[model samples]
Target: MNTAPPHQQAALLRRYQHRIHRVPRNLVVQPTGFCNLDCTYCYLPDRDDKTPMPTAVAEAVARSASELVGGHHRKPLGLIWHAGEPLALGRRRFTELLQPFEELRRKGLLEHAVQTNATLIDDEWCDLLTEYGFRVGVSIDGPKDLTLRRTDRRGRPAFDRIMRGVERLQHRGVPFSLIAVVSRENITHPDRLLDFLAALRPVSIGLNIEESEGVNTERHPPTREQAIEFWLKVLAWSRRQPGGTAPVRELERLGRYLRMSRTQRADRAHLSRVDPLPTIARNGDVFLLSPELAGITAPTYNDFRAGNVLEQPISAILREAHRLSYVGEFLTGLEECESTCEFFDYCRGSQAGNRYFEHQTFAVAETDYCRVTEQAPVLALADTVRKERTT
Candidate 1:
């Protein structure tokens, strides 16, 4: 490594900062810290705390949302309510939690969504959901057996109840998506997984593999070949079920790759779905990057609370993030990925939280998470294309 002057190094970093700019419009809120179920591989450290979000934090989020809508490079501002279990707050509390975003949503300036375990959604919840027209994402690990880790507090099976909640939503004509955690058991069983999810008719299917984060110490990472095969199987199944199942996220990413390749736009080559999302804890703390980082900690960054919007302006927090050494290193790592990684155009550089949590440093190029998430899916799609050409 060249030992350069501090100012010269700073200038060098700035020259490549464009590859890592972040102005996240989506705000993920942990409305409450109470859940009826206790998943075995949960990453949240305070899943049992019953305290709800202070009114001040909600107000700050609203202010932040208002500020974000006018940003130069900002995407549409979205308020995503997620936590120990957002549904456990009940309809009334949940509605109260959404008060800050309702006005923005009505103004057609904000998008509001929630992620729930789907065990507590009754007819009342469905009615409220329909009334507000809020987007919901249901958390289920595909089939019943695949959900062994996602049981109720008593260690009893919660899949049936979760399915019931899903049925309630379906009967009421409420739109929702499915978010399945890819465990060791489910990662190898893509056919059964796709069949189960396809039967649900959700708006979309999202996969979140179990990995090391927060309190979770181990991750059952898939082999690169296993990941490629599973994703290819999902893509193949998606093509056959045009009208039956929702669009899978992995397939959607592949779709993006196809279009990007066709256009061959170099400027947009290194873009992810969005930049690092800004997450707010129930009390008022604010953290940027991956939503998982909101609950987890890092040695260099501590709790990773860049700044609290309650104390300072949201813009100020973002500006002050310039000082975080890890943030700088994360940016440098992104520049490295952009210059070196073949999939940089599609995935940007994977998520900061994943790299930091797994490799314990944000300065690294890539981690095991990127191997399956960013590389495998695209490679699978490319493999299909090669096979088609040969045939």
Candidate 2:
């Protein structure tokens, strides 16, 4: 479908030739979709089933994962335990699911992490997480009022539970991070949000702009100008905080740019690591791009089984990802981007789901995400750095 001229295609091929054989370092595993709290803006829609992966299935996935990474010169795999709440599988099953990966770690094959809503965390959970050195990322918006919509099917506010979970993690001295979903209701009070998170003092912070494809489609998505304004305010607040390691998302982009320019590390870009950043669901289905695409059924199938790890090799899975027309477009965009934009070295381009939702194709130009992620923040950071140097 992409009909670029021969010369342009040749140049693009040369630029990306260095990246042809790169293997992924991170893999997201969904134990189940059995989350306790039901956030309004959740991208995963079918969270009611609450089915846990059988121990055998989890073992097979771990074995396949080990084989995949082992074939790639034993590159360390960062296994990210993600879900409707990975903790919903409970501690015992959770431990069981992670055992094979722990064995791989013992063999020096992989690393493990768990991303949770923190509503189910306890001292025991904290102890297990700390014992395994599992990096935990808590999902919280801002404050009780802002997170009022984060409730259960019974319409009970989960703020108290989540806070209790955070307290346990803090008390146990477990290293963890925070992930906040920014929406129209919360974007106006950026300073308040930052201040609230600052009190918790997370290792890092990730702020995601609300997308319209999931549970919150009825809610108004924030405009690009509004999101930019919110991020700018947050950046100003972050600069004033002393001894804080909480890397704001937008500021991290600037930091990533600086690091890439100085170090020339090809892996510094966000989503450019490699193909098939594996996202394995509870039923053994492996999603290629991201976990957000879990519930989206293509025109043919009714369920979210993109492919199964038990039946296919990881290399074949990655090949399928490469064959996608949108994947090619996304790669083309990245290859050409650096010529016109200095920040191209840092951007991994927009997430595939974002492109799919906004433009109906993963490979298309990221006009929406670019408005806030690329265009506004990079230019502002460049200007500020230039002004400071000149001054």
Candidate 3:
């Protein structure tokens, strides 16, 4: 934790408020909307669609990369294959899909990554992923008993297939990060979850608290206090590990924020004119702010599309994104959080998708999602650091 004096830290945080940028940092690409397993809490609306992105669409997106991220002066934009199981497209098609980004990768303007359920990993897939130098993130809830929510379309448990894939990756010497969703059944059992995750020896662990987003409306284990307690337990459990095995993702972010130097904090940016993260659908439509809004549609918000990369360049779409009502409302929400919320510096405005899904509007502040994901973790980590100092 940062040991700077209290007054100095407060002064630095106030200055950090102005460090906002409009540059696109992450481009989430959906190779296909097909997923092998029907996870119960999944927010995706088009997970059944097997239509892969046309090669032309990929070329178009690649062509606009330099302009979208402000050219080579800025760091490489993170090109993440997500929104569905990217690996489900199979090795041959996935390889062909990657061809368009080769020049961008060579130019150091793009970094490739994939987030998958890991139920289809094989030696061929591993070879392709390793050849392309793609960072992998596997989605697994926990042990077999806890992962009852992750099942196939026919209601068969997917734990065995998922582990088979994970073991194959381990055998291939491929490093991966684990992403788990903590639903009502597993939120109260952090110890078991952490222990199981640590045994996998992943590079890191990310936990997404079960949310009432998209079509999944049945909220479970709903309580602010329970969520906070769960996070505090997670922080305590992570600290007890030797060398912090598979460090909890939320706490790691908090630690980074707390330990950043004055200069580093000042260099960080948010509350920008445009959403820094953009998700490109299989057909080339672009959705700003939230990847969860890719397949979702609402008549009031022009279906939540900024523009289609197939019709215009990504730079043009982003340049005029503010004109979109939802985008403008999201910006307003950011301003409200910046002026009102103490945790604004941490989560920026908590996620625009959550605001819309929970309240049907993007111009709102203080949703249950932010309280659990942003506020609780910060409070838990701060309390831990304070206790350590006194000891």
Candidate 4:
């Protein structure tokens, strides 16, 4: 646990002032609310709805992008198509959805990516992916035994299907990345996970600790010991790589944070002004800070919607985002995190969705999500590097 001493904690809190610098650097658009697989741990509430984003809603999103992505942004906005298996929308319908953003892409205002189960990747899908120059991300949990939880509607394992899709991408020569969920079943087998990832050969890898969020109330969050051991194995594996560990997202983040000077670490500008990371639903409703919160219905929080783009530009919603009840409550949580957590400089705060799902409110700090994802990894990596320097 990164619990700062009292004097330093007070100074840190004074610096950040508990303000969320809301910036729209990325847009996560749900092309549809249907997934082909019934992964046991999926948090999406409407995975079976099969409702694709209306073309008009997509057009509305694009129209609003100018306001969100224009002006002083030095890089193109990241437009990620995710949630409920984006590929389930089908190629033609998916193409139609992408059409609205053609101008944005051409104008260099946006870059495209897709987070998919990879069970739908065929030559045609690969063609579409290549045509758009997408940064493809496959959601695979490792070999068959580890992925038994990821299944189709009839309860058939999707491991083989997912691999076939991966094979298709490799055969088509498309570069890609992988995002794997780390849970109880797989947390103790870091070597197995790393070996599988090495064989698959994604350009990069991101490990998302299994979370208790939205509809997935039953979660087996890894123990602190399990998480630390897992990350240490990953860090060691990464160290042995001749090139570097940059491919492992978690280790890379740890390295960068550890390398920062104390002054740089203390600089709260980047930490406090985290990208709001708006996730737009098929209906044009926007969920800020956390994409996982999209499409969830919590009557107490107005379904966690900042606003619907169909009604107004996302910029307008963002401009008034601080006034939204949940957003305000979340800011209060940040104050708590800054005042207490020694890892606040590195983590900023837990995701809004995690806070809400775990505690049922945004005005709280810390959760199993942060412990396994943030604290454990940081401690593991930092201890490993320090030991290495001394040795």
Q: How do the candidates rank by lDDT, highest first?
A: 4, 3, 1, 2
Candidate 1 lDDT score relative to the true structure: 0.78
TM-score of every prediction relative to native: 0.91, 0.86, 0.90, 0.92
Determine the C-alpha RMSD for candidate 3 after optimal superposition of all C-alphas: 7.3
Q: Candidate 4 residues 329-378, lDDT tens each?
A: 78778879889899887887868888988888888888788888999988
Cα lDDT tens digits for candidate 3, 1-391:
1235678555433432233235677889998998888988877888899999888888888877766655348778889999778888888788888898898788777889999888999998899888888889999999999999999999899999999999999999999999998877898899999899889989999998888888787756346777888888998887688974777778888877766634465546542333447788999999888888887879888788888888998877765555567765676677788899999877767788999999999888889899888898888777777889999
Backbone collisions counted per model: 1, 0, 0, 1
- lDDT of each prediction vs. the true structure? 0.78, 0.71, 0.81, 0.83
Clash pairs for candidate 3: none
Q: What is the descending TM-score order?
A: 4, 1, 3, 2
Report the C-alpha lDDT of model 2 over 262-282, residue by residue, as the tens digit. Answer: 877755543354445778877
Model 1 backbone overlap count? 1
The C-alpha stretches of model 2 lying farther than 4 A from their native spots are 1-21, 71-75, 262-275, 300-306, 332-343, 383-391
lDDT: which candidate is best?
Answer: 4
Query: What TM-score does prediction 2 earn?
Result: 0.86
Q: Which stretches of candidate 1 lie over 4 Å from their true place?
A: 1-17, 20-22, 71-75, 266-274
For residue 232, model 3's alpha carbon misses the true position, in angstroms, by: 1.3
